[model samples]
Target: MTATQSGPRISTEDFRFAFRSHPAGVAIVTADAGDGPVAMTVSSVASVSIDPPTLMFSASAGSSSTPTIRSAETLVVHLLAADHVELAKLGARRGAERFGDDVHWGRLPTGEPFYPDANWLRGRVIRRLDVEGATIIVVEAVEARPRDDGMSVDPTPLAYHNRHWHVLTDRSMLPPAVAPFYAVYGRE
Candidate 1:
């Protein structure tokens, strides 16, 4: 039999450091409590199934938006574009300042808050898994709206890696039709 070896168990810091090397798309998850709107930035939003049009994302329990999200029947997920770096940073901040007057947002017909200019998906909670100080929420999409400008996907999606924001650029790797959406956005 071949020898089997085990490496030393990694600490939490090491786990985080390893995760930092991978890049993830940034999204703003928003829900409306009876009072107003609550939001948080997450990089974990991912598609779970296409047949049913479902998606999932995890949120820390410490986030003020968590309770609201758990209580709400539906939530809006905004896939941010490269130009929306400020919005992501704003949502990452704690407190009422996130939905302040400075941010441009609106409520959907169903009352979920959304960014009119950004691509969004509205989903109804189908399953919620509670895991150590966090919740893993799974939702089945009920509505989806692409950017008003008719872009299928933002060519330059705002990504988070190594604890910093980044814009991925590799035209050769993109499909011909998807190439046009990566237009230079402001400072990018």
Candidate 2:
């Protein structure tokens, strides 16, 4: 939602309402410029201009990844797999020790670190739009799979709403289940 929304300075409730209104695909923005690695959960990530193969994501000023994200001119936006919720949470966390030998990490030709389990994308930061409330970062995709896991799009996407993480799976498409709340938020 646009900040101005055809009007003036909105109220705090308006912002909260806007944020809760939509279902957003959760993503973790990753960065590592020699001082270890860092990442954060951001729903603000989106494709800006396809002509130049560009995209962008915003990070809060108070984000622990602020310096790392701002310092590097590039980053790796890894779309999490179904089983990677823990990884997503780990990345979003602040001041946690990152990079375990158990988790996969690799380098691109340009020396960019990436995770293999990522739903496939390696991007480079292009420019930053210094807005009043947030930093609008623009990026260009350098490496990504045209078809991840041989699928045009993921069968399920990791989603977040109402302060909870959800697995939007194909099973959700099934007709009414025994659960009550399940009747409300239809699946798929």
Candidate 3:
């Protein structure tokens, strides 16, 4: 048992602060609602099982898009490249502006529109888990492919740390190939 057992419970602010400091790759979790393209910025997207080709992402309980994403049968999780940091902010913003004309989107074979350039993994909804304050979307990968011109994951990732976007480059840390687990996006 650690200090957590005798808890003065971790404050949400403190938890968020700690979580923010730990770098995470950003992804755009998207789907098409009946009306139009819908997506949200999610740092929690990840692969949970390889056997079934599964992935998961959590959405805030209060997000309006949560309902839409949950109701949809499938979704596309787009891995953000180093150059897509600005687009992450756009998806995270709260308002109709997120749906404005500035965004470029297209449909998948399922006719579900997604942000075309964000680099994606299309998945079918497997299950939904209602966590404390958010709903976790566990989806099984139906198709995993990169956008036509998307770079293979070897390019440096754009990460979020301390609530700011960062590029992973120390030149010194640049190896011929990144470690296997760190390979994200379309890098296989």
Candidate 4:
């Protein structure tokens, strides 16, 4: 146990271990704040609302791109599929040249840098909250662009768990188990 200003808190190692056991969808967030484009892979992206088309993700202070992403007013969130595992790894690698000559990326008409290979959403940062050492960004999506290859149907989603990347496939899915209350309410 660790003591914080408020009260006893879980050890950092314990907190990390708990979260590491949980799987999360992978996304690469890109932004350009005049100097140049910066990209970082994140597993914290989550949908917050549908009516307002809002989403949120947390950027760790340790990431090299966190400052750029925090300062940029607009950004592109690439919802990576299993085919984008390499891209995910590239962005996650510390001190890696994300936009080097070999990498294929382009700027959206709206001016934010984006990876054309993955499905992406262009949005403006609506809110920024600094919690602990991480910055939590809330974006209101205005435009979405799917991949040009038309592979949208049932694309295998990329996920991160226990410090490893995994692809969610049909074979990995378990049979549906409905709760009694939900089943009585006609919910699947």
* Whole-model lDDT per candidate: 0.86, 0.74, 0.81, 0.93
**What is the alpha-carbon lDDT of model 1 when measured against the actual structure?**
0.86
Predicted candidate 2 versus true structure: per-residue lDDT over 76-169, tens digit per residue? 8877656778877777777765566766666666666666666656777879887766788888988784573554354467877766777888
Which rank order by TM-score, best down to worst?
4, 1, 3, 2
RMSD of each: 7.5, 6.1, 5.1, 2.7
How many Å off is the CA of 40 in candidate 3? 0.5
TM-score of each: 0.82, 0.76, 0.81, 0.91
Candidate 4, 47-93: lDDT as tens digits? 99998999999999999899999999999999999999999999999
- For residues 1-188, write the lDDT of model 3, one tens digit per residue: 76778877878898987887688889988887686667789899888999998988899988778888988898888888888887898888888456567877777778877777667888889899998889999999888665456556566688888878888877636563755545655555
lDDT for predicted candidate 3 compared with the true structure: 0.81
* Residue pairs with backbone overlap in model 2: 172-187
Off by over 4 Å in 4: 1-6, 146-149, 178-186
Q: Which 10 residues in a row give candidate 2 its minimum summed lDDT?
A: 145-154
What is the descending lDDT order? 4, 1, 3, 2
Candidate 1 residue-wise lDDT, 22-128, digit = tens = 98999999998686788999999999999899999998999988999888889999888888888899889886587667779989999998877677899999999
Model 3 TM-score, 2 decimals: 0.81
Highest lDDT against the true fold, candidate: 4
Q: How much does candidate 1 score in TM-score?
A: 0.82
Stretches > 4 Å off in candidate 2: 1-8, 145-155, 171-188
Clashes of 2: 1
TM-score of 2: 0.76
User: For model 4, what is the C-alpha lDDT against the true structure?
Assistant: 0.93
